[model samples]
Target: MLVGTIMRKIKSRTWKKQRYFKLQDDCMTIWYKSKKLFPSLICVPLFPVSVSDVEAIREGHQSEVLLSIADEFPADRCFTLVFRGRRGNLDLVAESAEEAQSWIRGIRKLMENLENMGQRERLDQWIGDWFRKADKNNDGRMNFREHHARLFSFFQMADRSQSGTLEDDEFVLFYKMLTQREDVLRVFQQFSLDGQTLSQSDLEDFLRDGQLEGDNVQQHAETLIQRYEPSDTAKLLNAMTFDGFLMYLGSSEGSIFNPRWREIFQDMSQPLCHYFISSSHNTYLMEDQLRGQSSVEGYIRALSRGCRCVEVDCWDGANGEPIVYHGHTFTSRILFKDVVTAVGNYAFKVSEYPVILSMENHCSVEQQRVMARHLNQILGNKLLKSTLDGKAAVGLPSPEDLKGKILLKAKKLGGLEESFSGTADDSQTGEVSSGKSPPSYNLKDYSRLCLCVRLLVSYLNNIVFESPHSQKLTFISPVFLFPQKSKQRLSKELSDCVVYCKSVHFSNFKHSHIHSKFYEVASFTESKARRHLRDTGGEFVHHNCRQLTRVYPSGFRTDSSNFNPQEMWNAGCQIVALNFQTAGEGMDLNDGMFRQNGGCGYVLKPGFMREAEKTFDPETPQKRDGYQPVALTIQVISGQQLPKVNIKEDSIVDPLVRVEIYGVPLDQNRQETRYIDNNGFNPVWYDTLRFTVHAPELAMVRFVVEDYDKTSKNDFVGQYALPLRCMQQGYRHIHLLSKDGTSIPPSSLFVHIRITELE
Candidate 1:
């Protein structure tokens, strides 16, 4: 099976510098370009060499003929073969060429040996022995087809258990047997077709060949097919139904995909229901716990469990627009219009409109009106008019025209009879006696219009209160009306109208004594009104006078504050509004106003409403004491009999440095508390002291000295503090004081404190 002839190097320029060797048994040559290094080498294999034989020669292959000629061989002697080939030719490549030649020779040698063994039965018997051990099915012979199937089966078995295909134990056993000797290696090589293992295609090729050639290979083919193809026993489980999906979702282990499961199911099945569940704290825990889903989506899933109401806070913007918000500050600055749009889209998608919108108006009247207009635009006349007929009659008017025109219409109708009576006499002759018919009027129609206007104004005022798209919002407001004349006028104008008024602060309604008056003004179904009062406390009432309204409690007060909830509740309070600054953080009105033991409904603060509109930093300091006159320094030394002090009396003082020291005392212990100086030669005059002192204990100290005008007794010329230590027994000299006495230390003079602390 010699595939090619090798060419040995002859005398050449390269050969002179290095020696070359050749081997003829395998017809290959080895070239050692330089062997001044090893000149004793007579011949080495060169071009057109087979790597397999070259490797064998390098492993010290010695034919009987060559061993007989050698006298001695060194242990460290090395040999190698060099081969050259075309660049792109795979077969000519040394490694590939060697592999191909090796495969052919090994196969041919095995066949010849098998033939010499005499009968095919002998080979079959040996194969049967190997197959009995290798085949898990106890097949009769170890053909390539059977071996391929077994390997594939191993992988399949591993796949089934989802474990490693070749375990350590199995790998050890296989390696030990496979590498036993050359005979085993030769047999395995032939079976593997010189490749390491049979791939899927190789297995298929072997099966096809066995089938086409009548090779009695049916057993091997059957085993390969069985192992490689999926059996009827292996089918996937069925997809789950809606009920089944819910059941799965409810189960602990089955809830593995619950987060995305519901949403994915909603996407597929299009469930008609969705919900939003608000948490007390604005933590993303619920959303995070739901496996990276959005907060709203998580809330929807939670609501799908069963929820009819969701609560959200509302903020009023600069233009008196009411926007939904959850906390003290607007977490999201989206306008009320945008919120309506979003909710509308959601409602359209899910086919369910929200029933209630609980809104907490933290906006100004103007802002509320702006947002209300936007909301009315989106919600149409539903919010303004409970019934379609009322809406049509009222007719939606522009915001600008609403207040003036609506009020004008009310006034005109109120004086309708009067106007007719007065003009009746002016009509000439018997013009049906214009006033004689008793001035027929539709009071019901007028009342309906007024009710519509009232409803529209309430809707406009509490834009954040009503969620037309979702039934989740419950309007919450403080009953307190602003002290501004316009605000008061507006409140007085709207007081008769039916609207939900939550008493935030007792003081809001305390002045007007409107708490009891509210109940008397409107009528409610006995049962419904009682229930409303009972549920929300007496502070809450359901009124159906000319319109529909709900009264709730609100105001600013602490949980432990000395306020009575029952009193306020009985007084018809509905809301308790707490000032954000006064109330502690993490404060939650968990059970509504009536629930707290001392909760006087809700604490209401008008100041907080104004404060909410702007951002505040509590860390900033404010000026406290008003501007005061300051006296500049007048220095005086102890030993020198009080150098005449010069003082600038009136100077604008620094805001931070409020106090100024104008004089000092000379006494150590018995210091002069008051300043005294001689006006005349014989008499001493007591003067009111205006200087601060930093002197220690002194005796008979006249540290404070002031110069006053003799005639007017109005102006003090100079003031000074003298150290009494200078006159003491041991003290000979004293430090002169700067004009501004350094009393209380300069470092402590300009300290800053919070306004609250100062108060």
Candidate 2:
């Protein structure tokens, strides 16, 4: 058969890419993309040797030497050769024919070594000795059957088949099977065999006929390498530096690592970071120590190691005093001023600064304005200094002055214009230059201004407006006072200024309208606003804009803990109003905004403060523990009208001239106590029992005189005992039960009480 036909037949059976070979005087060479030689120019003496003989040589000699040869010349792409001039036949196996020739050279060296030892001639004599013993029939040429029978006894364990003869290919296969034991190579070797141990001429005939099976393992391995090189595992391993290995381990599969992985991660990312604990009355700084301070610092340290963000809350107090308190009632009075001082002090104390401070607002509009003004005053100075003095401070800029600060927050739409507009004078100048002036800024008349007032207000940088409602806040540059009148105008104005604003604040703003407006203004020709503004002008911006920024539910009540920082960020709000108790105790504040917990309070955990500081550097951590409650007093203005009360048998009489005490408790148990008239006048009957009959546990008391006689002539009058509970600790629930045990609801004829003790 032609070599090409034989090669084609081998290729078709082996499932390998076709390879062509060239026959040379010395050897046959196979070519693929690259030209690789087989036998490695060494061990050529082994060529033309019987497979059984090679096995015997390998078994009787040092196995390490053969392993070293295998390592040096892998058998996957090896070829075999048969030399005609050797004293005894040697079988050569190599990756390619060229390597087989190299093996011939190795055999020459072995022969030279034998000669140096004065045993070169003994090589032929030794083969002759083995031949005489093995060739029992002595036919001069050992037939395949005789060789196979002779070798069978030596390799009985490997010969699974009881074939009488072994072909050259069979002998090679048996040799490799015993030596390498490679499943792939053994399969190829098995398919190439045809019965008996090969002689020199037989081995040459087999190669020329292309009977050996080819393998595509090299191609497959290269393809596998190509496919997985860009996989996630590869990328992960690639990005991992020696130091980053532990972090990658923790981040990717933390459960697989030891608990000490946290320590390892810390070592990798500098775990000794600081964080600030936002203040709250219920926040026990010591508790944080026990709880393992996981404040903004914990978040930041995690983030600097890579955490996302942190959270904090704010509230507006009297005099626009924005503070950081958590409860509905400020147990601790904290002025925005105190918060500013605390933050400044904290900044001075800590080197690492907070990256973000999310503020939640819980205050009325009027109160918010007051708080905004306070924040403006305190933050303005810091901002100016940072801009001028080359220092850093996370200034809590008013909504009007936010444009200049690197970081600012807008918890609500309240003070955005103040933060972004530079100054009132600058705003005025801009207004004049633009042929418009913001309508007179007044809290009461604000409802009358055009939507532009609100639109302009929403453009402040870093401002966020958070709402408990579902609608998101956005930059409604000209917020329509009434939807009916200014929706179109506001929409148009938004399109014009979309490039200038960050986000719009709205409660359930329509999406279709926004989409339509975007389409309409996409082609609008006007003065170009900054393209980088967060809200408008491209696919990415539009995709982000679909999300609303601020949404305040209509009936939402102000409390501390429910404040959401992410919501505020979405709303473009910077200042957040928070009750002292809720958001103060266990919240993270890292993304860089000033927090004023409306009333004075302290952080529950001192360690948490440190943690927050580490997480969000430059955050102004403050403690507002020193606060006094407001005092209120009330008195009876008049006692002149004492009317006559008439009493009948078995009937109740209503008391006349009832006096209600404000901010005082009544002693219902002392109903029978009486007062003696100074002039010894007729004894007046006082129904003290009936007077004490009000809501049972409340401090309130009531006096009533029921006229039972049905005649308006008789008079019933009296002075009664006062009712009070001096030992009450806190506010108690009052339950007025009927004789049957059902409770009585409040009535018109009830008592009044005021808060007497403010602490």
Candidate 3:
């Protein structure tokens, strides 16, 4: 079919008609095609998009063609598509399922093609667009003297010794913010001798010609110095003047989304425990864990968001094949084979890193063969049948070594003796220790992977030993049923298989300590996590520095509300599992953290976290050498496309901007701008907010736009959050995102910021 043959944009909530939608081979175009025909009102382009950006596309109750934006996880049926730093997104609808399917298929094919080709040209176009936006003088190039006065304004944060130049580590930190790709960083570092630090000459050389050689490099460097070097400084010894460093970073090539970060250069050779792996609990359920419909889309959403670990509950079905769902609940069930098929297709599409298929087996012996056949047929080589290197290593393999592989984590049938030997018994061996539920037939040959797990996966109907509902692994629930919330003393059989995940309840952090190389992974509700964040945070940090922990929402959250994951991350806790169906500030922060390092869903722990020998307290952390409190000033000027608080209500909204500083002492961390009345389109506040924050590395600044409501709580419009250390001072455009994490394009807050020491 020809491109643009069938095009659509969702009807707006407040408007009678939406913009015109047209599909082309390379991109999608949305424009105002009015019947009155004076002229078109709007024309926007969404390009450089790929299959990875699509969260889901299926027939919806409201629209036949429902295309959900990937990763945004919009709460309702209608939400915008946000991807690749672009702003124009439409909550589109179509006439029929056939039409939507055709469009989805066509776009996916185009996305595949885009991946294979057109990257350089797309990057060039992106560069040109960004250059135009940053260039105030309309010149082809940016001048750092006046045009970039505020661009590198946060210079003090990274510049030590006041040398006006960032040394080796500082330069590397700067480049890491822009990109994590080694090749890109290598190219930028080549301009300097000994790679001590980058200078203006080095930057000018690389930006001007993308090379640092011949007389041309010096000529370009000199031209840049003449154009942007401070009117005062005469000459520098061998370093790039501050002007050149800032100017180069302001260019498109240095943009945070400059495609270099999309490269595969991250070091994945670290042990599995060394990185924070994205995971999802109840990965098959789309709503309440109790009674939600179980679909393969859950796996799709989690995996697409770089979630390396996904949960699957295998139960017997009426048919010969097995089914996946919350057992003995009102929740709907989906075919186990279908779930496996979906996993195989989408597992490595976003990230080539290893995937962990966390399985809870409960199928009958007859259906177990069907399950195995389905897994072997659908998953093919993607499934991990045996150890990658043929021989088992001493520790868990690195993600790099297991790339493009999927490892199954499930219980195997064994007695007290077999468990001691770490081998499977003939009694439905490879089958989980549950009653009667047979493990997959194909997997019967493989020895049971020893996994350390808690007594129950869930309090209500989780798989138990001997019986699936006894609440404990023993024959009865007396001796160990409520197992004193401490690390229950497990037999050698249970603790040995637990190479990675050693599940236990997180009652407190004091007793969870370990002197050996053992890792004990603890799970808790969000409320408990928050309590720890408030009360025993120091011990938690010390514990998480060496061990792993998993935090999920409380059972009381029937609607599946998520908590701000940053609170957990701040404590160095890994595996902060979220309910993939929910969207709020909590999920937004979750998406933000995993969005970096190529979204492989694994991020190496910070230096403090990797230091196993150190006892780093989160609250009373020993002040690092050469660190001081920063006096920060942020000016809130105005907002663009300040969307109306209520799209359905005609009443004009009074909007205000709230700037929050998150750092030590937690209290007194908030400041805001005065409200601007009746200016939903463009509010001008022009208010200044200031604060004293200790150590930029331990802090972050959050910007929130809200609609003032005296009778009720103020409603949130959008927000943006960035670590204080990564903030670039001067005049900056802070792009806003909805609570669900979708980008609110063209809707931005203009602000000026400066960071300096109080002295």
Candidate 4:
């Protein structure tokens, strides 16, 4: 296929220009260039997007900006490339339908290859990417200057005959020097008879002794030799070369995350309250909470990343419409209708599980009604307006029963029986009259208004018939209570949309256990949730098993920073909401937690957390039943192709690795390796770190690489995080990610992991 073509780039309605787009020969990067007066300027780059970075390819003007220009551009010729994480989408318009199809098909094929790439293939690609970056002149060779200072010694050593440049065999020698791992070499030589290559028996011994492979060690060794042996002669002899040995250790077979857990292996049939949901707080804001831009892009980003619950703070807008924003804050606003549309489009694009629209409604009754109409119309059947079954059940429905559905989590008023029984009307009338009633209204008028409100709700209920008569339905009414009332009156139309997760004020665990239904949900600020966890963690865990709980960040975090979600998760809180807009350790932990279970937005809670009989408190993990602690030993061996912390030409990082264990308070700990001065490339550590995890199932292990400094805190380079239970035991490669959780390819740590159960 032709790798390059001209396409019109669409940034906005008025910004559309022809640009040359090219897929590099590596098949991993797509580079584009705008026409310039000088040829030199044309060669200057905008940016190159990696094929693996693309989350999805949306066709036919799926993005808002693209859809806005539909009248000018042909729908068949327009498409959007949605990048992973928080990166903006790339919208382009082809000159012809054929060209658009060709580009789309070609990119899809490349993406498929990326997805199916084996361990060795991925390593080779990573190496090729590094070589390409170092080959500054693009001449298929690297000169001494392009090798950088950290590698200058290796470059000089590999450049035989004082050529000042390396090519072919010479380049291979340089690569070997660049990637040499003394730690792995020492282990390899210890097992090899010739101190060169390992025979099948020798490999088996290493697998049995070093990797702790129990049964069928010989078969596993043979498979590794066959699959990873780069030299054909060694493969024929049932032996593995050092290159092949390293390849095997870097492959998926050597990954820290267990391959079995990579799939959806957990039981997903449990009730919604029993699972930990990936949720977002202030999801509409792209930056800080105080003055951030509110855009529909936020909804798309969160949903596409497998966030099952998103906050939408609705406030009254012009023309009786509702706007979503951080209420009373300086943040910008987006139409509530647009948010609904975005959610409806992208909710099921990544995961088939149900999504919760966590509504923080501050809109007036009129605008609230508009919000309800928009959700009902835009979402259509995707909206869950009633319970799944005709009859009310003892517990909330499972995620399996609510697939592809969107549930509203908002305040609801009195139940249908009470609303139509005259009791509710009398109470509402008295409440309205007892408070500061409007001057135009008399006692008779107040009574009549309350009656009319009840009749209107009953008539709407009869027409919609959202649920069967067997169920006790609760619908919110638009009739506003007087100024003295603490809470805003909810619109019945919007309230009817909330079927499973009815938002309720939380008083105490005892009160909730007595009065709250399975469908009732309570939200807590970080401060309040922390207080509960600190004082009565067992009760908090018990409360979460029956009723859903959402823990959000404190309001004082005006910068939209996130709190550690692991704390809430420790309490079995189903919806631990975080500021998805920010990228830090908090968000990294959030991303790591949700990266498992096939990124399905719902992860089944640990068995102990789900069982009501077990009083497993995060504060006192050792008291839990069957609490078997685990001793985890990790040897930080080396780093490969570590990225520079800054863009300065002379910046040579003194890199260090820190391993952190996050779980119960008892298990939380961190240890670090001594810094390697002036070495970011192939820096060797071989430092061993250990931890005792009290709750392995709830623990997460994080590997962080930072550039050490003498006068200040270390600068972050990259890190990788995953549940400790998913961590594999063996020599493995920890692929590092940037602060934003995007892959920093070729930048990884080589480590050995051993986990032993302690009695």
Candidate 5:
């Protein structure tokens, strides 16, 4: 412990064998602690890891029970710590009731504080905490000089077969214990000479011949001596040494995350519009657009999934405050204040990126005032009240600069007026000029006409209306600019709120190659998006890069079914708004895409999508200049925890594996795995499936395990999908998860992945 820093000590504790100890979020230091002592037991970090709940526990005695790891341990006495990202529970026991209560309060406080932190701060803190707690000795450094015996013990504990070596799945599990990064794993695979297992001799040769990269060559050399080239040969490693383990951890080879790229400076430097934002449509509804309940949980759920943009439809409420719900429908109603509070509190919990509050307002002046007040009070400093430099920016601020801020994007009184300025102003100037216009309407009427009057309470808010793109609080409210003979006269009566956006009913792919700002925010339904994807995908890619486009569910989707977001993401549309309550392939793909880049909800678009001047035709395949075609091979070996679907018969499921390869060129994607029969519990097929693909970077492999049925459709069992880029080259275990993004305990698919470059 640091000298000045203070930590409360528990009064008493039971210890069978203590290894490591530390208090941190997402990870407990037990893994490293055991590595320092003996590597018999440790808790693994779950995927999309999170610390769910913390509560106090007590018994009849003064001591408090924090956890019950043993089966016979009393459940009534322990405080449970529920965590996700891995299978099973990770509970830590506290000594006294006071200690348990203190731990619970501290953990809750951190979780509550997550909302208040800026996006960059939260990510930075999380990364730093992972590294600090991983340094099990608490000596501010990690070294393996004295822990080689324990490292051997660690290797031995995982070598279940006593084959005297660790192969594929065992290797992955062991490497995961060291670091969760895939980049490091790729480099580690280069040392496997036999193309299967890493034996004691291979490890020994690696220790002697491996070249150490980066500063501190002497320390690395000393580490090698303590392990392989020990002065006393009798102390030579039985397996791998602690010094070798520490060398790997300290080397550039074992980076947990990108050491240079994990900071805010690297991610936050791009324009807000440049990022592909994770957004939600009808955020208040839990199930359907009509009958679902409108509550705070919807907002919480959306934000927790890394959604950076959320829609809120507001109207007049019973009390003085405004209310949120679907208009003219049976959907339940909730307070507008409640939604704002929810957004402000949970916005940064999943991602630290800026949140765009897209509000559709239909409220009286009194309720509008109430909304303004609640936004200002509840959100406080988190609300983006002004531009960063206290002056109007030429363009919108970078996402990095707007970190931890809530931007209200609503149709304002006087908004951005670009090429189609107000009639009076345009007529007086004879063109789109930077000059100001006089008040053409009554002031009282202006206040009543504008629902967001208090937020954008000035005539200057009409800059975007006069021009095209406006940097005023990242506001976006596209309107159809229809040409008319009396258009100039009609525009004058409307005053400064001369909306932008030229409506183009895209029946054909014409008028795409043109220079434009965010003047035309094209909106499309799911069917329309898919139509464009099939007919003219290249056109959509070019169109989405230059300007922002939104794709929502079609009107026929009365039940609010969501379309596959990956199809839209492939074309680079930023706002692929889906119904959050719906769970299926569409939502599953959405969850998978945004899980990267610290789950901040905003991912920097690929190089082709970000370059507005450059054109990348989706119709044209990506360049294969130095690349060769790849043949993917997977062996359906065995499965665990195959769920029983036939309850009436009370019989186990006859599970079969269907392996699919989704490639960049649509024609190359296909399913190849054959079905297995009659076995559900530990079924082994040993069947191999193969497919050929051109682009590995733009490909994904999905493993779906389902129960075979002759009379009806195959019942859904469990599924797993991941990018082909991160897949292991040899035998590996594919863990299964339900549609709700939770791990199904013991449900795993053991497979061998073989990738051969087609010459």
Candidate 6:
């Protein structure tokens, strides 16, 4: 077991104590127990942690809790275990550095074993977990009551000897009855020769007809039988049992999402503008804009979630450094250098794709220089200081071409020509030389106003005003006017960092086409972008095809709410930034869109949207060239092991499944099933929902389960969303996720999907 350690488990700075820790014999779990004396209790309660659940291990005082106690503990003896999804981190300090390394290496080795497990081994592990949960008394056996009342009747039927507890053979029978689906059984019987097992030829026929397997159906069926059949006799006889069929249906092969799309299979060599980049707005804020906490945690969370573009709002800080936060609100501030360091560390951790730092600069020229210095030194070679291969004349580089690089997106004093010519002053003092009036650059040139940093002004009536870029300003209650200050000089050090994605004032389609370069980008508020989509949808699509466009949430949403990004993507907007800290249907849709192509944070736009000659408008999809619609049919069969939203022991949920489609306006639709009263354990509703998707390429399907309440709004239980194109046909399992998009174990919906082309 190799269990030897006395480590301090830290909950926070003040909450830390020594605990007895040991690794179990299976090498898959670690147990930590409190050493506090309890005369009445027979044994010390031990908490077990599965190595498979741990996402990563950070050495030293990397976490906030660990950093808080850094002065008390040496870095080498400390480590943090980061669990997947929304689980909090676990910080620990060992007695010695060698001890910490032993635990880290041991856990990592067990995790490697878990990752390398075969399909059958994983399924056995899952079943073993269920067995352990059911064996509540630690007796390695389960009775009818321990399995829950929902399966009590089936358990009794399987227990022929009238015993309260079921033996292994009896438990197998009970399990088969508990999980048996009549629909699947009927299909199996139809495909079986003796109405008991599927022979090789029968399996081949089913694969060809039901699964749409082509050419090599016989070989594929043989492979599947050998892989999933639990019975060795079935493998020897080239046959499959009903249990094997069900196992195959629940695995990744039968998942709605195509397994092939779970890798980097997309054409990442296309220009950056030709893809929908996963972008985040005001990424530093963890809550509402007016009053929120700003920390590097927000950056780490977003970047690790495969966010390619993150917004950073920088203002002047103390000691000649710059700070990042919501410009003038009550939101807290974090050092600019810390954010840069965090971004550098986590940029390529999840996906080895380029990251774009969307800079919202409001600092003085001196502080801006400090920000540039932090970016240059902390980020080092990761930051793109110049155009790749000096290809500014060609066009914006592709994601593949700039992998592991960070692009700066902000206002620049001039283009690459001015930056390289050495005509731009690197040290222009922003103050007009002892308080002289600010000189006017070309009044017609809107770039000067864009380049000039804005000082937030607000009335004293406790009223907050939103700046032009959606940053809120807070001031006291007497209405006052803050006049335009002298033009703030641009730091050439920072300006040189903007090789691509230089922010510019977006006037109109004609202005951009005539004057703007491919590397230049424009920002738009949700309202403005919607207006353009309504008026000049085709023109907006054409603009996005050539240059990148970022559409952010409107300033009025101080609550940090997000708008539906699917509509923006429908119009070919490359960067549809959302408040990542906020979780809602908007974030759900964003997660769904980026959940394809290995979630590299870049998904290729639809062929029609990326076409050089713009012919398709989202508003008029029917009139577009080469448009063909598809009919999607989904049969909601049943839900398994649904979680109870209310923790009250006596309370039960009446769950209903809703199928929603998000795509072009014409294809947006929703249909739901009737609620199954007081049955969250195994709810069945053979309800069939249908959708006609006009633009199938841009369509997304979302499955949501809610506890039905006629008196009030339905309480959310779980949901799953994915692109329509990534969906696999035939029978599949839709594994449900919690509200925050984390998988809820043993909770899923089984369904049959069919997509057919329309005339």
User: CA lDDT, every prediction?
Assistant: 0.26, 0.26, 0.57, 0.83, 0.56, 0.83
lDDT of 1 by residue, 667-692 (tens): 11222222234211111211222232
- Writing each residue's lDDT as its tens digit, candidate 6 over 184-267 gives 787788888899999999999888777666679888899999888999999999999998998887788878888899888999
TM-score of 5: 0.58
Residue 429, model 4: lDDT of 14
For 1-759, candidate 3 gives per-residue lDDT tens digits of: 232332335533333343344453325322234333324423333333333355344433222113223222232323334343212234554445565566657656755654444323433333344334445554444433322222264445544456665444543343233322233234446665546444555655564444212356566566555544443443354355443443333342232232344444458897676677788877888787667868776787677778888878887788587889876566888889778877897799789888877666566556666776777678778876654565533455678988898765544232223433556343432322232222232221212221112233333244334475555432232323233332111222222233334343344555566332233355666787777877877677667766656777675576767776666776777778788777766666556556557778887766665666655445654443344567888878777556556744345668899987655454128888888877654567778988887645556567889999889999889887655655655445676787766664446676666777855
- Ranking of models by lDDT: 4, 6, 3, 5, 2, 1
lDDT of 1: 0.26
Error of 5 at 609 (Å): 1.8
Off by over 4 Å in 3: 1-266, 360-377, 412-427, 430-522, 527-539, 622-632, 648-650, 661-668, 691-700, 755-759
| Residue 80 lDDT, candidate 2, scale 0-100 | 28
Q: What is the alpha-carbon lDDT of model 6 when measured against the actual structure?
A: 0.83
lDDT of 2 by residue, 1-759 (tens): 012111110111222222223222222222222113232322222212221122112111112222224444444323322221112212223345454445445444444543343111332343343334345564543334443332345344434454543333344344333323132222224333332222223323332332221345344223323332334443433321211221211121111112232221211111111111221212211112112211211221222211211223355555555555433322333444444433433332222322222334444445544544544566554322122233322222221232222122222121223334553232111110111223324433443453555555554322453444435445442333333321111111111111112223221223433432211111100111122122332222222232212222111232323343322222222222222212221132211111111101111112222221222111111121222222222211111112223232222233333333211122222222233221111113322232322222112222322222335542324222112221111111121122111112210111112323343
> Once model 5 is optimally superposed onto the true structure by TM-score, how far is the C-alpha of residue 76 displaced, in angstroms?
22
lDDT of model 3 at position 379? 77
Number of backbone collisions per candidate: 81, 177, 5, 1, 17, 4
Q: Tens digits of per-residue lDDT for model 5 on 1-759?
A: 101111222222454333234443333221224323334333332222243222222232212222214343333323444333213233444444565466556556665665455323443454455335345555543333312212466566655666655544444344334333233233335554553333455544443334323345445445544544222432353333333333343322332122233223236576665677888988988777767778676786788678998988887899687899877667888889888888988888767778887666556655666777788789888887655775434455677787898876543333343322432244311211212222333334433444454445344556435655655443322111222111111122212221222222233445655434443355577887887877877778777766667788875575878876766776778878988878777676676556556678777776666666666554455442344568887767677546556654335577888876654554245563556665564566778887886656556566778888889998888877665655654435565777656655445666666677888
- TM-scores of all candidate predictions against the true structure: 0.21, 0.21, 0.60, 0.87, 0.58, 0.87
